[model samples]
Target: MKKCPNCSADVEEVFELCWNCNYSFSEQKVIEIKDYTIQEGNREVNCLRCDIPLIFSGRYDFHEGARLGAWGNLFELFVNSERFDLYMCPKCGKVEFFIPLNDSEYKKS
Candidate 1:
């Protein structure tokens, strides 16, 4: 473990940025985290590493392409129609995709 030079918070050696204060050890400065994500749903989710609210990118649908290649046909069955919601952290630029919860769960006001 190592201590952040800016915030004096203990940070794992593997991580470059301090989790508590977004300080970059290599850059020797505090990382600016101005963008915060606001999801349409009321479901509040935070980044595991940065501990900041994640921005809801959008919803995406996956399906087989019109033209199948040699290996494409092999995995064709695996690439069925699927919908997923995408989320990303503005601070750390970390991304996460999840199967969306029930629509009723996000009754936007």
Candidate 2:
């Protein structure tokens, strides 16, 4: 822990800016290592429209090919796939996504 120069509060060693005073520590090397072990697994979320628990489905990847036009290879951008949690509400006949495709469960299934 490092003491903030402006407010004298204890700031995290990895934090460059003091949380209390917002003092910028440009000279310091803040090493931020994110640990993914503690990340929570994907869980079911209720549908906003029907309040029904959503189901986890499979994942799909979408690749955008280069556009063949006058300016060749100008717009060769990659489009990310849309991961969706398939959910159906029998009460209201509503089908929607409970979670996005970037979620961990999307890759798992």
Candidate 3:
């Protein structure tokens, strides 16, 4: 484990980037998450590689298939179990993940 120089946050050895401050170890930079929002009615996204429209898959929860045990329950407490909407390209099978602005906003009708 190493500490992020920028944020002094404890970073795991397996992870190259710091979760707290987004500090890159190799680049020696603090990368920030982009501020973007998905339009409520808009759905289609183009695939950069295949140039095909991305199809909306579904929401994924990290804790979905987690086993119920003492350590598993303890692990869940420290982890962020945010749901992300998955999009996939039908032709190339490339996947992309996006966080919805409102979790309970709309259905895919």
All candidates: TM-score:
0.43, 0.31, 0.47
lDDT tens digits by residue: candidate 1, 72-98 = 767665654666688899999998888
Report, for every candidate in turn, its global Cα lDDT versus the true structure. 0.76, 0.56, 0.76
Query: Clashing pairs in model 3?
Result: none
Query: Which runs in model 2 stand beyond 4 Å of their true positions?
Result: 1-41, 66-109
Clashing pairs in 1: 37-55
**What is the C-alpha lDDT profile of model 2 across 1-109, one tens digit per residue?**
9897777889889978877756778854343544433222245557678788765443334445555687545553433344444555556666664335345545422
lDDT (Cα, 0-100) at 32 in candidate 2: 50
* Stretches of model 1 off by over 4 angstroms after superposition: 1-40, 64-79, 103-109
Worst 10 residues of 3 by lDDT: 35-44
Best by lDDT: 1
After superposition, candidate 3 runs with Cα above 4 Å error: 1-42, 63-71, 104-109
What is the model-wide C-alpha lDDT for candidate 1?
0.76
Tens-digit lDDT track for model 3 on 1-109? 8999999999989998999988899999988766455554246679989998888888776543464676886666655556678889899889988876666753332
Candidate 2 — worst ten consecutive residues by lDDT sum? Answer: 33-42
Q: Is candidate 1 or candidate 2 better by lDDT?
A: 1
In TM-score terms, candidate 2 sits at 0.31
The Cα error of candidate 2 at residue 41, in Å, is 8.3
